[model samples]
Every structure is written in C-alpha cells, then in structure tokens.
Target: MTIVETTSEVEAVVRDTLAVHQSFFLATSGSAGPWVNGAYFAETGLFTLSLVLEQRGRSLAAIRDNPVVSVIISTGSPTEPFLQAQATARIVEDAEADEVRRVLLAKVPQVEPFLGTPVAAVELRVLSWRATDIPNGWLPGRDLYDTSIPVAREHRG
Candidate 1:
C-alpha cells in the first residue's frame, strides 16, 4: 500500500477512490427517520458529487428536510481503502439539470436509461473526509481533511 501522507496525497486518494467507485451508501435523517440507500454518483468537482434521485423517494424527502448527510464509498474489502465523508446535499435547480445530466452520463453511462424517468439531480458538497484501509492503518489526525478549517491564518505583524 502506498503511503498516503500530505494533504495533496490524501486528496488524490479521495479522487481516485471516487473515480473507481460507481456507487456509495448515503445516510440521511428527517421526519421519516433515518434512511440509508445505495446511490450511483459522479464526481462533479473537488469534493462534490452528483446523483439522479427518484423524485418521491424517501432519501430525497429526507434530504429536503435535512441537507446534512453522510456517505461511504467502498468495496467492503478489508484490504482495500475506502473513504467516508460528511456532506450537505441539495436538489439541483431545473436550469442546472441538463449540465448535471451530461456530467452524470459521462461518468455513469448506465444511468442514461433512467434520465427520462421522474427524477431530480442532487448535488452533494462534501465537508470532510477520512480514508481507512485496515491493511495500511490510519494516521489519526493526519488522515483526515476538513474543508471547514481555514487553510492558513492571516498574520498581522
């Protein structure tokens, strides 16, 4: 296993993980209670993913009430590395659906057949992430990235 040190390396690991994984488990909670479901995703940007969700699905309803969510992307192999992320989600605007649709199909062509169905494009903005591989082990704080933190503090001398 390659040593995953440094923020850039961690980011690369995340991008690589997202690129190879076609689906992830999304967990959400709202009035309907907690719900976890498999969702096909496409990385639309740095720390961002897009999905086409059924309009009336419980997942969508939960997301509508509570945008906060968590996702796990993994093959469930102990030796293989996997990432877990906390993200905020939102339903894409109608004007943006076409672009999201194009991007989604580019990465997940299998979704093409469902594009015409009654579904809405959802975007997930990942807040933080951590990668864990039982074989490689974790470096605690070094292995986690949180976007909410300021990269650098302004120095007033």
Candidate 2:
C-alpha cells in the first residue's frame, strides 16, 4: 500500500476509497435522539457523497430536524484504512433530483431497482474527514482534513 502524507495524496486515497466502497454508516440526531443507518453512497463531488433515503424514514426525519451528520466507511478489514467524516446533509430538491439520481446510478447501479420507489436522494457535504493512516503504520491514528475552507477542486463529480 502507498503511504499517504500530503493533502493531495490523502485526497486521492479518499477518492479511491469512496470509489470502491459501496456503502457507509450514516448517523443523525432528532427529537427521538440519535440514529444510524446503512446506505449506499456515491461520490458526488469533492468532499461530497450522495445516498438515497426513504422520504418518511427515521434517517430522513432526523436529517430534516438536523442537517448535521456523521458518516463512517470501512473496507471491512481490520488492517485496512477506514474513513469517518462530519457532514451536513440535505434532501435533494426537486430541481436537482434528476442530476443527483444520475450520479448515484452511475456509481451504484444496484440502486436502480429502488429508483422507482418513494426514495429521496440526500446529499452530504463533508465538513471534515478523518482518514486512518494504517498504511503508514499508524494503526489507530488518523489524518484530518477540513473542507470548511475552500480548496481547489471541482464541485460537481
């Protein structure tokens, strides 16, 4: 495995990880307290991911109440790197649903079966990311990247 030490290198690792992972854990909070759900995700842009959610589901309801969320994606291996991030999520508006669907389908075709169902696409813009540096012998250590500050990257995937 390649050792990642710079921001650009870490970005590449993140992109690669997102490209390969099919699902992630999404955590949200609401009047009912906190909740977490597994969902398929597609990398939609720099520090961004998109997933489908039931319009009236707990996760969506939580997101409606609080846009802030935590996400975790792993390779499912103890020695492999994993990713955790803090993000702001929102249900895709009707105006952009089509485009978001297109992007989601391009990455996760298995989701096509549910596209006709009453599902809404939710967009997650990561505020900050913590990526494990396992490849560099940092077993539990993670390198942090903040996206709150503008970076030179395209907004659209």
**Candidate topping TM-score:** 1
Error of 2 at 149 (Å): 3.2
Tens-digit lDDT track of model 2 for 1-157: 4434466666766777787898999999987889999998888776788888988789999998999999989967757777888788988878678877888888889989888898888899886666776766655544455536564123312
**What is the Å distance of residue 42 in model 1 from its true position?**
0.5
| TM-score of candidate 1 on Cα atoms, chains taken together | 0.85
Candidate 1 lDDT by residue in tens digits, 38-130: 988888876788998889999999999999999999998757778887788989877787777888899888988888899899999876777
Give all candidates' CA lDDT scores. 0.80, 0.79
TM-score per model over all chains: 0.85, 0.85
CA lDDT, candidate 2, residue 12: 68
lDDT computed for candidate 1: 0.80
RMSD of each: 4.6, 4.9
